[model samples]
Target: MKEIVIIGAGYGGLRTVELLSGNKSFDITLIDKNPYHYMQTEAYGYIAGRFDMSDIAIDLQGLIHGLGPNVTFIRDEAVQIDETAKVIILKEQRLSFDIAVIAVGAKTNFFSFIEGAREHTNGVKNMQRVFEFRQAFEHRLYAKLQNSQNSLNRAGDLHIAIAGAGLSGVEIAAEMAFTLQRYHKIHSEKSQRLEFSLIDAADTILPGMDPYIIKKTEERLHELGIKIYTKAFIEKIQERSITFKDGTILPFDFIIYTAGVKGADLIHTLDTPKNRQDQIIPDETLRLQGSKDIFCIGDCTEIKDAKKVLLPPTAQVAEKSAAYVARSITRLSEEKSLEPFHANVDGVFVALGGKYALGILFKKIRVKGYFAYLLKKLISRSYRFGLEIKVNAGYKKRHVGSHDTLCR
Candidate 1:
């Protein structure tokens, strides 16, 4: 039996396990620092309190246990991969594997040039940080309410700035704007006015996205009272203010940095060919260059398409590459020829607060407003449902000897 070791429990890693667990010839060991899978794509909603813990986090222990005895789930951190030795170095132990997959995902990039950016700004990349930010925001609102009831003089407008007007920044700014407005209406008290700003150095928000999407998103942000600051390069980030290149110092009550991301720190330690972002440059078959048994997928790998353009490290790309890698591994075990992976993006949906969204399907079909939001929610629900079904089916097959029966 092949001893397969997969690192990280993100979308890619989990999907790979789901596809390969049914194979009787493989023993799968899935390792991750966290015991649950975080739905990072829904981070905006989660931060806005639109989703609870159960909506965004799936218990890895329960899911893996349901996959049968052939699979093992380890809640440990993977620090490095000894490529020459075919071993993974974890914080607690060293693991040897017949085959290895690196899907450790990405980390937020706080550019070194920006002074105090790392120290002053918060991020929504992980659940802990998200929870902290949400709590702090709520406390700030409550404080304002208390001050109003006491008839104390208002300090100033409560400014919340989102640095980097990419997909994450846009979604977060929109959600916060809507939520803050709702909070104001509910309180109906004279409190500190709330102001939101979306800052980016790029010429436009959501750079490299379709022009129509950019236009529509800008419109919605404006409607929701969000200020967009494009081409306003940030030079420094102070404790309560950010300095722009043009000598503009903007003060804020809070700031979120969603400007950029790079491959996880572990990826940089490996002596493998990688792109500028430190993402491994995998071959057409999604294997590490010059290595046959080691594969790289998800945000840790920089994959290009037939046109030689790098694919964005979105969940869609991660899952597609993961599925391909799983199939390639199966073919390798069977001594069959492997096929090259072709990347394709079927659609994209961006929620713009409340029940509004913007989407593009098949690169041509555009959707907006409530229907797009509903579509996005349905897609997210479908993914969760599919995972539950796969786990239940695997458990039933292991105990009842029947693959058709799915245990609820």
Candidate 2:
């Protein structure tokens, strides 16, 4: 059997593993620091307390065990990949592989040049961070309510500033606003007590996105009472305040840094050719430049199209790249010529507050309101169903003589 090792259990890594698990000729090992796969796309809802932990985290061990006995799951951090030796250096031991895939994903770009930005603001990159932020946010609201009877000063009690104003930032702000509205109604408190501001260096929110989607999103944000600050370049981020390049200062009780992301730290340490964001520059076939045995996909690699336009590092792109790479690996084993990867973004769905959303399908059709939200939910369920069905099928294949209904 050909030894195959995949690092990172993010969208790209997980999908690739799922695609290749049934191949008996390949022995696959998946390595990641966490044992559960965190559903990052559903983070905003989780942060808003609309979803539970189980809704966003999936047990990797259980999934892997069901995948097949040929697949192994290792819960360890990957420190380096020595391409020359065809070995992966982990914190505990080294792993050798006939084919290796690096899909470690991206990390929050705190813009290290800005003073106190990384130290002061919170991020939702991982489950732990999201949980921490949610807890802190709820606690602050509760504390403010308790002190409302004793103190007249509640100046910045519920002030929230989200830096970035991108998709993540916009979603977070809208969800929080909706949640706060619900809280205000339940407590019979004035809505003025709650304040939210979405800041971005770009001239408009969701810059580079479709104009109609951006316009509708802006309208929704305005309806939610969330403020938008454009072209507000951050000079520094203090614990309770943001200093802008134009010498404008904004104060807040809490801040979320959703500004940007770059390739993970391990990607930066690799000796391979990397872009400005430390993402590997893969060839047309999505393999590491000049290296056929190593394939890099997802947020850890920067892939450009025929027009030289860089693809956005979204989950959709990651999954597409992953599927292509998995097929390419199988083809390589059969001594077939590899095909160039062409990324096509079929659709994008952005969830606003409550059951409201905006979507662009096939890059032409547009959807709005509750229907868009439902479509997004349906799509999420379908993706999860795909993964679950594989697990069930694999389980039946291993234990039973025939494939049968094993899950309700």
Q: Give candidate 1's TM-score.
A: 0.94
RMSD per model, one decimal: 3.4, 3.5
The residue-by-residue lDDT of candidate 2 on 260-324, one tens digit each, is 98999889878888988889998889898899899999999998766788877889999999999
Quote the lDDT for 291 in model 2: 93
Candidate lDDT (C-alpha), each = 0.88, 0.88
State TM-scores per candidate. 0.94, 0.94
- Screening candidate 1 with a backbone cut-off below 3 angstroms (N, C-alpha, C), the clashing residue pairs are none
Q: Candidate 1's residue-wise lDDT over 161-213, tens digit each?
A: 99999888999999888988888777733667888999999999999889999
| Candidate 2 Cα errors over 4 Å, as ranges | 149-156, 188-192, 388-408
Q: How many residue pairs clash in each candidate?
A: 0, 0
